[model samples]
Target chain A: MAEVRLTTPISEEEIRKLKAGDTLYLSGKMFLARDEAHLRAIEMFDEGKELPFDFKGLAVFHCGPIVKQDDTGQWHVVAAGPTTSSRMEIFQDEFIERFRVSVVIGKGGMFERTTAAMKKYGCVYAAFTGGAAVLAADGIKKVEGVEWLDLGTPEALWIFEADNFGPLTIAIDSHGNNLFKDIADIAEKNRPKAYEIIGASKE
Target chain B: MEFAPIIEKVAFNLMKYSATVLPDNAIKAIKTAYEKEKSTTGKAQLGAIIKNFESGAEKSTPMCQDTGIHIYYVEIGADCPIDDLGKFREALTNASRKTTTEVPMRPNAVDPFGSNSGDNTGRYIPWINWEIVSGDKIKITAFPKGGGSENMSTVKMLKPGVGLTGVMKEVVDWMISAGGQPCPPTVVGVAIGGGADIAIKIAKKQLMRPIGEPHPQKEVAEMEQKLLKAINTTGIGPMGLGGNITSLAVHMDYAMRHPASLPMAIAVQCWAARQSAAEISADGKVKYLHHDIKD
Candidate 1:
């Protein structure tokens, strides 16, 4: 119900104060990583290798963007939207604990393990509207850097300097509330009536 | 072979147009849903989607980052001068590569050996579904299928006795399981009574039809309406965040079943529903059907 504006390097207290259903407009540095990047980062963590970038206190986007390079060799985000966040469910809990990331932004929400970690680690999950790629790109001020291009463009780790980069809704709050789970519960309860109308029952 | 150049250009435009501009039917449905949506979260999701569409059009960028795998439904006339299907396939593949860099579409085609071709074309890519008819022309529809929604698509075999009711049940279950994953308000395409592969193909093909248009047959049309209603009632809403409009439409097509089999397939098209079409005449002239190409 409240509109909150946050800058990068946000603190646990700021994330903890937000609740499910609140909207956020984020500014400052954010990193984009999806399936391949996540796997690679986790491997680096286990290998005791020096990570290329610091994720602590910043947001990590589950995005694979379409970027182009100019003559000056600077990367530009053309269309950057969230991939499904739930796909990172396996690595997220560990990722949060290790990286100290305060906000996780993506679409379609994450699962129980990630939610529990968010609550335990004082982090929140915000959703950028799914498929709203252009709007998402509009908020990005610059591509600060990129790593893991070897993984391919979409799967690479992109460091973005975001400016008012969201109208993100808090789907999973640090206090254990989850909007997606609530909606799923409602859909499950409503299913039987639809079944009756269609004259079909659970088999 | 005479019309190869025209086919290639038209195919390229189809891919580019579909990436940046949504079809008219899709635009209309989204606007209507926005006006009527009751849930706050649903309204917010739709509002962002609408804004994204405008931004995409203004900037000439792909509407979604996925850009998707390029799939084509091609119909070639029997009397068309391009008698060699290989030439037609080659033309489409070349078009895919052109559009990938020009439209700057994501290089979505990945090799099974763990490498990206770095262009949208690869083995059997720009996957063409071919049909032949009477005219001396070729028409092609480009469908950019996003990964999230494509993952939500399913095919199942049911008992013959389960009938229409069973189909509805499965569709509902699928929608529930899909939740916001496919980026609803999705368009659900269902095909019944074919082999597993055929049913899946027809279900996906049905998605290319204009939204809200009913099937020509009364029985099939009624089934579509019923399925639509049931899906909306699920309260999955936009992005499955809960609302009155979970789906924009439900389209159904069917074929005769084997005596022992009732295979069904459900194809989920995201609300973006990006597709475009073009026709190439025997004389080498190309006409864009669903969208206009700027010179």
Candidate 2:
């Protein structure tokens, strides 16, 4: 219920102290990477190819932003909301284990394997509200750098400097608590009630 | 009269408006959700969503990063001055390309195996559905479907015996299973009684309606109300973090079906619910129907 301020390079101790329902406003550095970038980063790590940026203690955002360049050719984030994190579930556990990222910022929330990884690695999944792109971009003070433009604009990795970048709800904490899963469990219990209300049965 | 230029301009404007501005009703629904949300997490999510759209309108930026794949529903007049329908298609395509740069929409069209088109256009991209109707004007609605919600859309063929109860149960079960993936506080469009493809198409089309607008038929409206209540009861809430209000509304439509088939489709529109419309007269005057566009 408390609003916490997190600045990267966030520490494992700091992330461990956070709880599942707390609100967080993050500042400092965060990297935007979605599906393609996630795969590429992991592949690069496995292949012993050094990635351009070190993810240590930084927030990994699940976002494919709408960025534009001015006449001066400096890229500006037009919209930068989080993409669905569940899509990254396959690589997230490994991404966390290999990259040492402290915070995973995204929408929707990740599932069991990623939650287990967060528990083991002291990482937290903080969910920015889905579709809050302009607000997210507003917090991004500058585009520090970009990589893999060949993957197309949306799939490229954008390095951003952020200031008070969220009202992120910690949906999964380092303590094995998962808000999304809890809600799903509740929905499962209520499913029969919904069916009863509709005078129907799933079968 | 040359209609291509007018159509191009109108389509471009609609795409821009939809990307940058949340429709009035969608904003209203989110406000209501914010007020009614009991959980702190859900409330914060709703509050952020409200601020995002407000900021987007002020700065003229996209409300979400995924500006979405362009989909248009066109109602053309039989007596319209436009002689060539192919030109109309070309104009819409051109409009999509223009909006990509001008609104600076994210280039969302990507080939499954290859790469992004970078222009929000490609083979069968900017998919348009046409209906020939009875006026000298064409009404176009731009409904850009984002990847997250679009991925959650489904079509299922239930046995005819399951009937309305089956449809209701199926929807509730699916939403519960979908969890936060489609972006909760979604506007769910449920279509029944058509073939599999028609059901899916109709289901998506139903999303063009404003949030919480009831279907005109008494029985259909009742169905919507019941489904809405049932969906909210799940406590999936905003962004599926938990609370009341999993969905803003459940819009349902149906068609006559073959006796042996009972097909249903679920189309979800995320909280952004970006859509806009404009009517182009034969004389080329653009009338904005959905939002008040300031020139």
Candidate 3:
């Protein structure tokens, strides 16, 4: 697995070259949004309002982070680990197509529909280590700003300036290889053997 | 005894510490798993997680952004004489509020169909579970349950006849499917033989035990070992990136139930596995447990 460092607004060519199992350390610009922010994004589309920022060739992280404000009122990202992506499976295909996101970073694999979207739309889903919140925050160089404050802190849109922002595993690649799905098949095949080792079975 | 102040201060520190630092056992488990993991992806994943915990402690920042909703297991002494019954509960609420600023906790509490309170508190924030103990001391444990792992927790009612095999199968199946979602290399807690809600509640409580501590019952301890190995062989690995280990430990607690029923609940805690324990004596001397608080 080749480890590559890339900035945001990554090219379609760069995404296409990546494969499942590759490790990536992304830097530069990326955005964070979770369940509610996605709702707001989609709602804006419904109302024909422009999204808060340019979406083409960008990275969107699925996360809700802990950010603290200093006496000078500057915000610091305290913890910023990826949330599970499976919860957003319903919105992802549309999100990818609508936003032209080349990279979607989160943990917990999404389903086949997402895999299809990845293949069809030239996007890739990467798995950031789950619960490595502070580690992820450390890679974030700055908090550019946030959006949708009314949606609460956890659900707001946080844009970050990053440097070596991840040691993310490409769980799903544009080529349609799904590490999450493949692992399940391996586990299923290994199950009966495991059951046998435990002497656990129907009598 | 005048216990309110002690409780409030203890709860506040515990919340901050647990959020920022991985419990000692969790750190050891990750280090051990990193060494044992053979695959490059799995090793790197485990290594990154280990560093994450280290940096969290260094910066005094939360190990995970979620920091999770707070749940406490409190043991109150029956013989202890505290003036106000409500003071303990009030302490929990106040501590939660105070920690929100000091820990700078993200306000995760919401009204479901409504909105967030932004203070991490509302109806039943920092949910507390109480039990009466024989000594004149109160012991409190704080566990932060992240939404990712909490969402994967399961409760099931089996027809008793499926017996042990059925139970084990269901357990392994969930772990396999859950994959990296709940954060693999997880600590699994199983509660067996209780009512529907009791099964789930006790399962969450069972997770409070330190990782790798075996149950006293020989049968249960043996089963825990077997399941731990079983799930690890699935190759879900660290962060589900394909290593040899998927679970650091599997804990199961049993209780009496109706003869025909086998209600089981699976409580999943992510690799962060944050926990803090403290004891307040009747005279009000407080001591912390599980993890250190050195500068």
Q: Pick the candidate with the highest DockQ.
A: 2
TM-score of each predicted structure versus truth: 0.98, 0.97, 0.97
- Return the lDDT, model 1, position B210: 93
**Residue pairs with backbone atoms closer than 3 Å in model 3 (clashes):** B1-B81
lDDT of each: 0.90, 0.90, 0.86
User: What is the clash tally of candidate 1?
Assistant: 0
Taking the tens digit of each residue's C-alpha lDDT, what string does model 2 give over B168-225? 8889888888888888799999999879999999899889898999999999999999
Assess candidate 1 and give its lDDT: 0.90
TM-score preference between candidates 1 and 3, better one: 1
Q: What is the lDDT for A62 in model 3?
A: 96
Write candidate 2's Cα lDDT for A44-144 as tens digits: 99999999978999999999999889999899988998899999999999999999999999988789999999999999999988888888887899999
Model 1, span B1-295: residue lDDT tens: 6777777888888999999999888999999999989998899899989999978977889999999998998998898887456787899899999988888999899888878888988888989988999999889999989998999999999998988888888998888889999999899999998799999998998888899899999999998998888888889899877899989999999999899999999999998899999888888778888897864
Candidate number of the best TM-score: 1
lDDT of 3 by residue, B1-295 (tens): 6788888889888888998887787788889888888988788888888888898889888888888898888999998788766788889888888887788887888888789888778888879999998988899888778999999999999989988778888898888889888988899999889799999988887778878899899999998998898898888887777888789899988899899899999999888899898888888888889767542
- What fraction of the genuine interface contacts, i.e. the true contacts, does candidate 3 reproduce? 0.82
